[model samples]
Target chain A: MALIEVEKEGKDMAGTQEKQPVRVRGFPFYPHFLLREVVVMCIVIGSILMLSSLFPAGLLKPADPFDTPSPIFPEWYYLYVFGFLKFWTFDVGPIPAKIIGVTLPMVVWYGLLIMVPFIDRNPSTELKDRKFAVGMGIVVLLGILYFTYYSIVNH
Target chain B: MNLPDMIYKWFDDRFKISELLPPIVKHPAPEKVTSNPLYCLGGTAFLCFLILAGSGIFLAFYYKPTPEEAYKSVEHIMTAVPMGSLIRSIHHWTANLMIAAVSLHMIRVYFMGAYKNPRELNWVVGVLLFLVATTFGFSGYLLPWDQLAFWATKIGTGIAGSIPVMGPYISLILLGGTDITADTMTRFYAIHVLILPAAIIVLLGVHFMMVRIQGISGRL
Candidate 1:
């Protein structure tokens, strides 16, 4: 009788252990994650297709090596760098202004960006808590915008 | 067994796709990121890349890499080929949008502090991807072989030439000479279509894998 009772207890323990839930980390990725992605992708692609049909890209005159166009600038994204070249014309002794202009912006931009993960020791992800970092981002954005505008107007 | 089951059993015995697909198909994504619009930027940028690839392949069918024929070929595509202008426009617009979307995605990641701890390496890969995308833009700009393309490239190469010590070498390597000639066009063409695409794809794969393993970062 005692042996049978012990066997029953063992079976009960095994059943309970088997019933313990597996710790699920997050939501199922298929229907939920994939559905959202599909929707966003559709919107993006549909808009691009619509825009392409509505307004086709223009082709300019063939390239001439001898003749340089007035107000020569790169695409809109590069306007900031072009404007930076024009703006930072002050010369330092020995070093050319062009090098300073180019190197300074490149260094500042990539330096801060690459250093962020290392320097930003704050574990918090809150915007209000990361005031300095957020402030710096806003300032850099405004600076780029201003330079881009300057390039457009001056050109 | 039924025909469908028989077919499945045959394939499952040979490939084991049924065993392989479940984990991938049912992979978990962080609950916080599922509903957020900000998290969608990366996906959006990737979509733009897909558009670029499809449209670029179409453009390549008619594009000529030589200086003499490059401009004329582009013009012909725009004016002559069926739906060519539309494809070209899509490619152009998609490139611009990809750059914009990638920039915004990086900014969002930064502000969200998604580049913390275990995710830092992916952040570096993201930065390299950004640089590669910008290079793609620069190289592709010259391929149109127009007045704007020519001058813009000259100025761009000039900027590289101004970079203190290695400036001259970098410019020389880019141009394949002192000036923008036939060689420069070929180099840009190769880099735009071949080198950049390969590098970006590999980096993107790494970036995606890291994201998958790490899951999404916690909400701010």
Candidate 2:
């Protein structure tokens, strides 16, 4: 508050001759903001270095079409889709289980995700005001987590 | 004046550096953003991306896209080339870290309601970038042509092929045929090195520009 007052006073003192640029309330972007970013970058790079050295990337044998490995998995991020496919057993009317399984995670899930801002018409950013949206976000997050776990454990 | 000052003045005379510096140099980052750790996620992801790009270029120097030579090339890189193993490891870790950071950044944006109002387009761009990043991982996964790479891609393409309507076409475009072959390796290599990098650069530009124009959610 005091800093803003000083800026306001500084602006007024400039009068009509040399107007001061309207400064936003916060630390200057130069050394202050970028310094923090550099710090975070260093930390991130250091962790990656440690992790890479500790457990280097693995390599399996050359690909042989005839030899299929048991319990083959996609990348970890896609595990939820794999899990959902395995979990869903029943058919929805005319649509087969496979179609629904693939469509639900890949199509419907991403479609809803892409449409979130539109779907959530509420303009409020506060947590208390957005119970429904927050609740839905939690539900989706938990669902993904559950499925990722399911994909690994069941297989 | 010093040599550096002379050089700076030469460019300043031509470019009007003083006028160009104010908007960005004068503007301050919001207090909430600087103080909060959650705000770091997006920048962290960007940093990871830079590392991946550097390390990936190094790995690419020795990597082969052909089916027969691809595995051997990677093996040679791991065993023979100087610091090749370390570079490959760095690339691997940075790629995973980038995906994790991107996901966490999305969660932060969602929870903070930063995706609402004027920032909606930016949010969409963010989602697109996430897709591109994951697609980058998927394409790179198949490049080594090892057993794991081959089978994982087989499963991945199979899953895409199972999607209704556009499923088969997407698979066809991805695999370049009915099955994974030499063509598939080349396609994945091209997508990983060329297509996705171009997409990511454009998307990132839009994303950053939107944030600059709209400002962070803390202001609202």
| Strongest candidate by DockQ | 2
TM-score of each: 0.91, 0.95
For each candidate in turn, the interface RMSD (Å) is 3.7, 1.8
lDDT of 1 by residue, B1-220 (tens): 9999999999999999887876676665655677688888999999998889989989999999999999999999999999889899999989989999999999999999899888988898898898889899999999999999999999998987887787889899899999999999999999999999999899999999999888778574
Kindly state the number of residue pairs that clash in model 2. 0
- In model 1, residue pairs whose N, Cα or C atoms come closer than 3 Å (at least 3 residues apart or on different chains), thus clashing, are none
lDDT by residue for model 1 (A37-119), tens: 99999899898888888888877789999998887878788888888877888889988898888876665567677777888
B147-169 per-residue lDDT for model 2 (tens digits): 88999999999999999999999
Question: TM-score of chain B, candidate 2?
Answer: 0.98
Clashes of 1: 0
Worst 10 residues of 2 chain B by lDDT: B22-31
A1-155: candidate 2 lDDT, tens digit per residue: 74575455435434522466544456556666788899998899899989988999989989999999887877899999999999998899999999998999999988888889999999999988999999999999999999999999998
